[model samples]
Structure formats: C-alpha cells, structure tokens
Target chain A: MDTNDYIVQVQDLYYRYDKENVLENINLSIKKGSFLAIVGPNGSGKSTLLKLMLGLIKPQQGLIRLFGQDINKFKEQHKIGFVSQKANSFNTGFPATVFEVVASGLTKKLGLFNFLRKTDHVKIKQAIESVGMGKFLDRNIGELSGGQQQRVFIARALVSEPELLILDEPTVGVDVQNVNSFYGMLETLNKEKGITLLLVTHDIGTISEKVTNVACLNKNMHFHGSAEEFEQLKINDVSEIYGHDVHVLTHDHHHHGGGHLHD
Target chain B: MISGLLQYEFLQNAFLTGMIIGVIAPLLGVFIVVRRLSLIADALSHVTLAGIAASLLLEKKFMIFSGLNPLYMGMAFSVGGSLFIEKLRTVYKHYQELAIPIILSGGIGLGVIFISLADGFNTDLFSYLFGSVSAVSRADLWTILIISILVIALVVLLYKELFLLSFDEEYARATGIAAKTLHFIFIIMVALVIAASMRIVGILLVSSLMTLPVAASIRFAKGFKQTIFFSILFGEVSVLGGLFLSYYLDLAPGGTIVMIAVLILVLAIWLKKRAATRSI
Candidate 1:
C-alpha cells in the first residue's frame, strides 16, 4: 500500500476479559477515506476490535497504530468520532436538546469554562444541516424517532469535523426504510466529504452493496478485502467466516440470543 | 411564615443552608441518576454518619472541645470516606456496586462503635440523626457556600465531559475523555455535598435530597440540560417549602424537607402520567 493509503494498522492484537479471550491474534489495515463494514456473528469481537482501534481498550499482546504512530501517542483526540451500537446507551431522557448533544463533539477542543462561541455555533448548525436535522435542532433528544436519534448521534460524530467516523451497528434497530436512507447518507458522506467510515453491522444485505471494504470476524478474523471479493467468495467461505450460513439467512428475520433489540 | 425566618437566626440558618444543599445535591443527583449511581450517594451518606460519629467520639476522648469545632473533623472524615470509596471502586472495577455495601457497612459499623463509646445516644446526636435547623452555625454557612461555589465551578468547567460520560461512558472513553478521573471527582464532590448537608438534612435524610428532586425532574425534562435545570428548580422548591412548613409545625427540618421532596416527586409523576393519558 502507498503512504497515503492506510489510516489504521493493527497487528497480532489480543484482548481478553476474565480469562475469556474476546479477540484472538487479529491483524488488519484500513485505507484512509475508505468506507469499511465489519460483519460478524454475535459475540464475534467486532465491537472489541473497534474499541481497540479507538484506544478504548488496550491490546494485551500486540501493537496497534493510527495515523503512522502508536494510538497511545495520538494527542489529537478531537480528530476522531464514534457512535456506539446503542444510540440509547446514553440517557434516553437526558435533558439536552439535539443541538447541545451535537455540539458536545467539540468539548475537548473548547477552553475550560467556555460557553460555545459564534464559530462553534455555526459549526454545530452546519453539522445539524449535514444530517438533515436543522429543523429539529432545539427539539429534545428523547422526542426523536430511533432513526432520527441515530442521525443526531451521527451529527454529533460529524460536528467535530472528524477525519474518521466509526459507528458500531448504527442502523441495527432502525426501520428498513430508515436503514436505506442512513446508508445512502453515509455513502454521500464518504464520497462527498472524503470522510473515512468504519461501521460494524450484522446486516449484510445493504452493507455489502454500499461499503467499499468488508471484514468478517468471529473470535478470530476470517476475511479482510474489497466488497467485490466478498461477493465472489463461495457460500462455504461465507459460512466458514460467520460459522454458519443459517445464521446469516435467519439474522434479518429472527432475534439473536440475548442481543438487545435496538430502537 | 416569613416572620418566622427573621425571628429565629437558627431557623434562618437552617433554611438558607438547607436551600443551598437542596439545589446542589439534586443538581449532582441528575448525573448520578442518569449514570445509575443513585444508590452510591445513599451509601456514601451512610458512610458519612460513621465519620460524624467518630469525630464526636474523638472530641470527647481528647477533651479538646473548647474553641475547636467538630464539624471540620466531620468534613475531613467525610472527604476521607469519599476517597476510600473511590479507591475501593477502582480496586473492584467490574463489581463497582459491591464497593457501596462494603463501605456502607464498614462506616455504619464504625459509627455504631463510636456512638456507643461516646454515649451520644440521648444527647444532641438527634440533630445529626433526623436533622435540626437549630444546630447550623455561621461557620457552617460559610463552609456550605464555599462548597457550593466549588461544585458549581467544577460543573461548569467540566460540563461537556461530564455530559458525555453520563450519556455514554464507553463512547466517552473511546473518544479519549478521562472518564475514570471524572468519575472519581464526581463521587468526591457528592461526598462533600453529603457532608455539608449533614448539619441541616442529617445523615439519615441527606440522600433523599439528592434523589427525590432527580426523580421529579426525570418526569418532564426531555434531555440532559433540562434535567439539570429542572432538578435544581424542584430541589429548591422542596427545601424552601419544607423549611417553612418545618418552622410552622416545629418538626425536624431534614425529615420535613425530604418528605416535601418526596411529595413533589409523587406529584410530578402523577402529572406526567396524566399528560401522557391526555395526549394519547
């Protein structure tokens, strides 16, 4: 890969909790400005890998680097944004307006005890508009639909003007129609704004069409390549990556074991 | 009713101090409630009882009761207990809730021993138990004021960080917010509020001030900022109203204040349900 191609590099990463290995010997490199989707079965370490990449969790046995340096050394925290799978993971009844939640993206860069400035306000407005939520800026977050709430979170992620936006299963609980629009908007963001996108989802029907790259994962990674390569892979290969083809066939219709049904 | 406040300095002090704690505690409570750490505050207040009991016992044993006040010692013990909880929480990272019962039991056990040793059962320890407005001094007022200012300033400076963490700790940590440090600072602040509140609300009822207003606020507030504001507003109303009623009824101020807060909480929940029904 060329110098400008790669934005994230992980090598031989390992993570465990309470003597249970969550991630096992994972190695992956992601291209800058590329849209990547990570698909996996439940408890497949997809979220854990993203957490490690974002430096939320430490690798027990291997090195992970971002932007050509160790993630631990990266001081510019404001340059990246993340949206967890649970959009409602935050307080569903928290007292903030959509605008305030979105503007919180700039919290790290603002001076201590400083209220938002005019430029900050302008950027927030821009972010709201970017997510087509300008009309609801002052509305309470709890009043929003799941799709709209997810959009607000996306706006929160975008308000920082991040170079990389990592969303973990953002459309999991959204309606099928909303999922289509959400993916469309994300594709626009990746192509129009040149924003590097890393999304984790179990839904392959839509993601396989839109994302440029795909990574299949279980406790260990199985595939990391272009989406075209993923489509060409045999059913046996897909089954090996996901551990079972029935799971993928039934995922859209049935509820997985103890997995939260997101709203 | 207003004349009562002016006629009794002790009453005035109680009302003022109670009002301050009323606002600050519930303000802090919003975060705690959102973060599901409401019970932690309850545990810490109980722990503070041990500190107060120990201070009383120490004062009696050392015979240093002349010019020195025991409240300072109470505050120090409270802070120490707060730090102890923080340390324990860190040590038991996955089982954080377990720290609450351990510290609470330890504090209460020590409190039982100290209170027994000091023979403070029939004495003015009732003021520390159910809460009496008559015990607050000018010094206590000053201490409450300083702590209130510190709480307000810290909330303002770290508003976004706290908001982010309260909303989603994993996301906040993922984005490089020092969530651990913030959590420690928050618990310490809460401990200070509980300590400061002990003189007015008493150890038994202090956690009620922290919880009831938050319960009321969550009924109406839609998001994070409104919850904070509404919680403070609700707390102020409950405390001031309770103070006035306490004076009229000649009851324990802490008990009355917490009772009033509970009433308001019930009223708010009722009104919310009514509104929901109407809308439906």
Candidate 2:
C-alpha cells in the first residue's frame, strides 16, 4: 500500500515512565479502513501506544504520523475519534442527556465562541442513530446500562464525523452477554461505515475473529500482520512476548484451559 | 421590603448585586460540582478573606488605602490562590485533592494574621464575614456588575469547551481542545465569581452559594441544560427569599441565604427519594 494510505505510522517509538521503559523500539503503521486490534498482557504498554497515537501523551523518543503528517504538526484532531476506557474514567452520575453528550463531540470542531447550528443538531442525531442510540437521545446518560453508556460514548465520538475511531479497552465494565453485540457494532462501523478502527484490548480470543489485522505488543512490537498470520504464530512466540506460557485454543470453545492474563 | 428596596440606595445595591450573583454562582457551580471541585470554591473564598483582611489592615495603617475597595485586593488574592492551587495540583498529580486543604489552611492562616494585626474583628470586618444588607456600596455594586458581565461572557464563549473539559478531560485534551488554557481561564473565572459574590454571600459562606443550589439541582435534572436551569432557579429563590427575610426579620443575609439553599437541597433529596420509592 502507498504511504499515504496509512492512517497511523509509528517509527522507532520509545516511551519511559521514569527509568523503566514502558515501550521500546516500537514500529507500526495502520492502513486506512483497517480494523486493527492491539493486544497485550497486563502492563504491556498497549494503552500507552494508543495514548501516543491520540496525542494524549508525548513519547520520549520516536516519530508518530497521523494521516501521513507528523503528529506534532497535525491540527485536524476532529478527524480522529477516541473513546478511552469507560470504567473509572467518568463520573457516571453526571447530569447529561445522550444528545448533549454526543453534541459535545463537536466542541473542538465548533471552535472557540461558536455555538451549535441547526445543521449540527441533525448531525448529532445521525451520529447517535449510527451507534444504535437513537431512542436514548433524550434519556439521561447516567440512567443507561454500562453497554448502553458505552454506545452513547461511541456516539459522542462519532458526532465529529471522524475518519478513524480509536478505543482503549472499551469493554471494561460491559456485561459478558452485551460484549458480543458491542463488538458487533464496532465491526459494523469498521466494515460498513469504512472508518479506520484501532482498538486496544486484552480479549485476544474473542476479538481475533472480528479484527482484520492484529498487533501483539509487549514492551515492543512483537508481531504486526494479518489476523490469519497472527493466529498461525507459534504458541512459543506468544509466550515469549507475554513472558509466560500461553496456550491458544483454535475453536469457538468458551474455556481455553489455561491461566490466561486478562487485562 | 419592596418599597425599602427602591427607597434606599444601599438596599438597591445589595439587591442588584445579590440578583446578579444569584444567576452566575449556580451557573458556574454546575460545572464545578460536576468536576468535583466544590471544595476548591471554599478554599478560594478563604483566600479572598485573606485579601479582604489584609486590605482592611492596610486601610487602617495608611489613609491613602482607605479610599480603595477591598474587593479588588480580595479578587487579586483569590485569582492568585487559584493559580497556586493549579500549580500544586500539577506538582502533586497523584494527590491532586491535597491542593484544596493546603490552600484553605494557608488562606485562613494569612487571614488570621491580618485580622489580628488590625486589632481583631471590628464592625467593618463583621460585615465581610457574615454579610450586611446596608454594607454594599454603590461602587461595590459596579464592581460586582463588571465582574458578572465578564464571567457571563466568558461562560457563553467557552461553554462547549468547558462542557467537554468537565465531562472527560483526557478526551478533551486528545481532541486538541487546549485543556490547559481553558482550565486556567475557568479557575480564574471561579475566583472572580467568588470575589464578586463576597459582597452578598460573605467570605465564610460564598462557596455555599456556588455549590448548594447545584447540589439540589443534580437530584432531578435530566440533562446538563436542565441542571443549569434548576441550579439558577434554586439560587434565585435562595437569594431573593433570603434578602427579603433578612430585611423583614433583621437577620444576616448570607446566613439566611445559605439556610434557604440548605432547605432547598433537603427538599430535593426528599423528593428524589420519594420518586425512587414510588418507582420501586
């Protein structure tokens, strides 16, 4: 693929918290319209990599490019929709309707001193509808279930009409039953809406089937390729990256029969 | 009370200032309460007290300073204290809440020093502490008006940015919303509002004006805009009712206003519990 086709590019990225290195010699490039899942064990710098890409934090050393432009120089932030981990990051009791929460997504695009126009209301409604939250537009955000709240947050991110959607451990507090539908919605967004998706998750087993691309990261980029090739990676290679023995089960079985680190 | 409000300039000044603050206090309070920075208002008000006490001492010592309004000095200290709190929050990121107590005690410590230096509490200081209906001068009203206009304008201009920042700060920063700059402006506006509110609410109880109405509003408000509307409504009721009751009953306006707010909050809680039980 051409370099311009890539939505995210990270070269020789290094991040450190004090003296210990969180990520080292990391390199990655995500093509446009690709559903890529970055999976890793606990404390494996998966979220850190997402944060760097979203410009939430600065890397100690490396080059990060968004849409082929240096991240530091990229001003088109509305082009990238980001939903951080839902649990513990927000005050659930905050008084806001789904429409209000989603409308706030256009804040940066609206710029300083600018109020929402009539056209913006239609867009906000459309965004909420896309996330299957059209009925919950007037409902209190705090009153929704965890899965519904997550969907409202996704709608919030989508209201900006972003070309790329990035989520960091998006299903933390979501119920096990709802997790499937949540992933389904994301899959639909990625495939049908054609939005570039970069999800940071630890549910490697369940998410592997939906994602078109996979990047197994632990401190450094261990593997970056098609999901099929990733599934073919030897268990020993995965164990080395996890720093522990991890058994991979190839079927739709619920139990993997191993002590897996779910982070 | 109506006739007295129009007949006396002091009453007019107090009423006008109280009405303006009634609107803006709870307007900004919705954001403050949602952000969980209610204590920051208490801390900043104490800092304003220190400034007021220092100004009183200076006025007693120098004739030239006697002509100056203590509101300006109080506002300066409140703004400075706000900036210091922000700095401390950055310095101790993990223990960010520590900033509130550190500044609160610092404010009281400085205020006590200034008060003692001026030979303890006098009639002038008494009004600043608990608020006096006749204490608000025409000049003080003008100061309050100017600050109210600035605060309202800033809130309108930065409403969307402020909403995003209060909702999810990290997400706001990720979207290049200039979080730091907007936050600085926000805290400074909080300081100004606290300072301006002192003439009606007094230093000791100014934070109650900012928070109590918001606390009540959160119980029933279904959306952000509704919360704002209810907060402002509660605030107006408290201020107007308190002012009228204070005039009729010869009570301290600040105490009366805060007590009214407390009653409203209690009513809201009771109503919310009733609704929940009914639903069950």
The candidate that achieves the highest lDDT relative to the unseen native structure: 2
lDDT on C-alpha atoms for all candidate structures: 0.82, 0.91
lDDT of 2 at A160: 90
- What is candidate 1's lDDT per residue for A1-263, written digit by digit as tens? 56346778889988999999999989888889899998887788888898888887788888887877788898777778788876547767677789888988887767346778899999999999999999998888878888998999999889888888999989866876567678889999999999999999877666778899999888888899999998898666677766655334434333322122111
- Identify the leading candidate in terms of DockQ: 2
How many Å off is the CA of B30 in candidate 1? 1.4
Tally clashing residue pairs in candidate 1.
8
Which residue pairs does candidate 1 place in steric collision? A94-B223, A94-B224, A95-B223, A95-B224, A95-B225, A96-B223, A96-B224, A96-B225
Task: Give candidate 2's error at residue A110 in angstroms.
Answer: 1.3
Query: Could you estimate the TM-score for every candidate?
Result: 0.91, 0.97
lDDT of 1 by residue, B1-280 (tens): 6786788787678878987887799889888887888777777777778877777777677776534565676667677777887788789999988888887788789889999998765556778877777889888888888999999889888998898888777777777788888988887888888888888878888888888898898888766778888889888887888777887888777888888888998999999999999999
Q: What clash pairs does model 2 have?
A: none
Cα distance off (Å), candidate 2, residue B51: 0.9
